[model samples]
Target: MLQVEDLHKSFDDFKAVDGVHLSVEKGQLVAVIGPNGAGKTTLFNLICGQLQPESGKILFNDDEIGRLPPFEICRKGIARSFQIANIFQRLSVFRNVQVSVLSQQRLSNKLFHPAAQLAVNETNHILESVGLLDKNADVAGSLSHGDKRILEIAIALGNEPELLILDEPTAGMSPDETATTMALIQRLAEKQGLTILFCEHDMEVVFGVAQSIMVMQQGRTIVQGDPQAVRENTEVQQAYLGDE
Candidate 1:
């Protein structure tokens, strides 16, 4: 559902993303893993329109979105969660998702309409999908760290994206939270048919949950394959695991 070809991005003399290529098929769960400075986040920025590629193409469902702005790219059925939670902390969890849903429907500015009544069912449905239905009435700032991450995912779902890009979805979670979040991601792919691509530093999470993996080094992909194949790759062990 997504294709990135010969992508390149640079900062002065440094190459943050150099000649990288990646693809994620429909309903696929893919992970990109590498150490710090390997350019995973830069690649995401290029894909999501936070940064334009110096060269190369980013195609979603065969449409070239390389130069589109972030909002236009979002409207083209792509949604992303940041490394940090991005939500209205002062609002109720339900309100957070409701705002997103309302914005997606272009009703965010309908001041004459009852804001609480707009997209009620849609907001509740997204909350339930991410296992946040019970906490819908709670203030977003009051949720646990792991729950906050889940809430961000719930917010991303409000866009009804065909492909979801999660940047470190389980970054700061405890073991239990990591397991639960990964399980939710897998379930979302299977049940909701959402194609997921995520960047993670956790080896266990990447190998355990991802059906396919891309191992990157110094801004380029060195290996790409199924989990078992990638796990046993000599280059990955030598370049990624054996580096230090």
Candidate 2:
């Protein structure tokens, strides 16, 4: 559903995303993995239109989206979550999602009116899907770190996106939290038939949940394949995974 061809981006002669090419089919859960400076996040920024590519083309559903603005790209059915929690801290959990739902439906201008109330059912369903329905009335900032992450996911889901780009969905958490979050992501992909492309440093989470893995090195795609093939790739081990 997404295709990035010969994409390149640079900052002061340092190429952050150098001639990278990749694709994610519909309903596939793909993992992007690499070392610290491998440009995974940069690639995401380019794809999401946060950073314009110096050259190359990004096609979503056969439409050219490389030149679109971030909001326009989002309107075209792309939603993303950042490495850190991106949420409204002071709002109630339901309020946070309600705002996103309003934005998605172009009802943001009605936020001060009773029209915002129209999103209640949709907001509740999104929160329930992310397992945060019971916490709907709680202040978002008061939640545990893991719950905060799940809340962010709920916010993204409010957009009803066709493709979800998650940057480090399990950045900081206990093992149990990480496992729970990964399981939730897997379930979402399976049940919703959602296409996901996530960048993660956690090898266990990536291998455990991703149907395909793309390994990056110094801003370029080095190897991509199924989990076993990626695990056995010498270049991937030497460049990022190491012998361990």
Candidate 3:
């Protein structure tokens, strides 16, 4: 569903992403694993049009979208979450997701209709999928850190994206929270058949959950294959996983 080829991005004298290649097919759960400077976020930015690539192409469903704006790309059916918790801190959890659903349906600014009632069912459905339905009326900022992360996922789902790009979905979570998050990720791919591409530092999470893994070093892919093949790859161990 998504293809990134020979991608490169540089900042001043340093190359953050260099000649990276990645492919994610429909309904597949793919992961990108690397050390801090591996450029996974940069690649995501390029794909989502947060930053234009210095070279190469990003294709979604056979169309070139490397130069499209972030909103345009999102409209084309790509949605993402950040490494940190991002949500409407002051709004109710339901409202945060409601905003996204409204944006998805382009109903965010209907003056005659009360936004509080807009997209009610859709908003609740997304929150329910992320396991936050009971917390829908709670103040978003009052939720636990783990709950906050899941809230962001709910917000992303408000867009009804065809391909989901999750940046460290399980980051900053306790063990139980991490388990919950991983289960949701798996459910999205298996039960709902959502295509997912993510980057993670947790080896167990990557290997245990991702169907395919891509190891990156210095902004390039060192290995890309099934979990077992990637786990046994010598270069991957040396470059990143060995330290884990």
Can you write out model 2's per-residue Cα lDDT over 141-214, one digit (the tens) per residue? Answer: 99999999999989999999999999988889888999999999999999989999999866778998999899
What TM-score does prediction 3 earn?
0.96
What TM-score, to 2 decimals, does candidate 1 have? 0.96
- In model 3, which regions exceed 4 Å deviation? 111-115, 241-244
Question: What lDDT does each candidate get?
Answer: 0.91, 0.90, 0.90
Residue 155 of model 3 has an lDDT of 92
For every candidate structure, what is the RMSD over all alpha carbons to the true structure, in angstroms? Answer: 1.3, 1.4, 1.4
Candidate 2: worst-modelled 10 consecutive residues by lDDT? 235-244
- Residues 142-238 of candidate 1 have per-residue lDDT tens digits of 9999999999999999898999999999989999999999999999998988899999976778887888899888999888899999978998888
**Deviation in angstroms for 239 in model 1?**
1.6
User: What total of clashing residue pairs does each candidate reach?
Assistant: 0, 0, 0
